[model samples]
Target: MSKITNLLAGLGGAIALNVIHESLKKKSKETPRVDLLGEEALQKTVEYFGGEIEDEKTLYKATLAGDILSNAMYYSMIGNGAPQHLWLRAISYGVAAGVGAITLPEPLGLDPEPVAKTKTSQALTVGYYVAGALVTAGILRAVARKKE
Candidate 1:
């Protein structure tokens, strides 16, 4: 029971942290744009490879491709808007929760055995959350650089 409680606490903490990080990212205003020229270049390359885009459809296709790639790049960099980030954040919180469950102590009025176990769990859980945060931030930074 103590383990479960500890795990829950750790997970909760991680989730809160992720939310804060996302808010910070949004506050910074990382904007995303569609690169029409890039799409045109890609279309030309495809044509060179014997895949021709008819003139009437070329503009439409280029715009569609540009929008897709631009959105992908934007989402990857601005993870606050990406579903993958939410999933990752959840996983990170779960890990922290599991650790907390094992290491964190229960409340002062609670049993000592549970408390000790919770403490151990929490220690590991916090570590996992920290690692997750670093990894997420690094990924976002890499995506931003790619856009540049």
Candidate 2:
């Protein structure tokens, strides 16, 4: 697939993931708090650079943007191989990310509660990534079909 196509699909998936996460977080206590993790990481990153962020809202916004951009690039890798492997690539990327999200925080000095506090949270976290990856794959497939 073309780079532009890959990027557009990746952006769509990333946006969908964020939308789902943001909406569910306000309504469910068990929803994955990936945002919290992101915010913490962002604050520490800035601090590491000798800068401090005093405004909570700004920090949150920056974290959200960072999440979307990073995820977009990650999902864009789904287009790296033959179209026949699209589903496998999507699932592999999504599951890897989901597992990483829940497993990597504590080792990195960030709290894990936001993402892995409970089995439900962990499952939901993984589900969200899978959904995002499927969205990206679906977009690519649709585009390919239309071109044919």
Candidate 3:
């Protein structure tokens, strides 16, 4: 795939993931608060560098931007190989990221409860990632077909 196409597909997936997460968070307390985790990490990183945001809103915006960029880059890996494996790559990347979100926080000194509080929370977290991946794969396939 062309680099532009790959980046666009990845960006779409990341946006989709955040859209589902933000929507669910508004209606359900059980929804994962990945934002909180991101905020915490950002705060620590800032402090580590002797910098402080000191404003909640600014911190949140920064974290959200960072999340989109990082997630897009990570999801872009799905375009690394043959188009035939696009779905597989999407599922694999989504599941891995979902599982990692739930499992990695504690070890990394961040709170895990935001995503792993209960079975429902965990399941929903994974579902959001899968939804994002499916969106990405669908977009990629559509573009590929257009090219063919």
Highest TM-score against the true fold, candidate: 2
Q: What would you estimate as the lDDT of candidate 3?
A: 0.89
In the range 1-97, model 1's lDDT, one tens digit per residue, is 1233323333333344444433442232221111222344456666779996667566656655454443233223324445446446545544553
Q: Which is superior by lDDT, 1 or 3?
A: 3
Off by over 4 Å in 1: 1-78, 81-118
User: 1 or 2, which is superior by TM-score?
Assistant: 2
Each candidate's lDDT (Cα)? 0.41, 0.93, 0.89
Rate residue 118 of model 1 by lDDT.
42
lDDT of 3 at 11: 93
The positional error of residue 142 in candidate 2, measured at the CA in angstroms, is: 0.8
**CA shift of 63, model 2, Å:** 0.5
Q: Which is the winner by TM-score between candidate 1 and candidate 3?
A: 3
Each prediction's TM-score against the native? 0.26, 0.97, 0.96
Which of 2 and 3 is the better model by lDDT?
A: 2
Cα RMSD to the true fold for all candidates:
21.9, 0.8, 0.9
Off by over 4 Å in 2: none
Clashes of 2: 0
Candidate of highest lDDT: 2
Off-target runs (Cα >4 Å) in candidate 3 are none
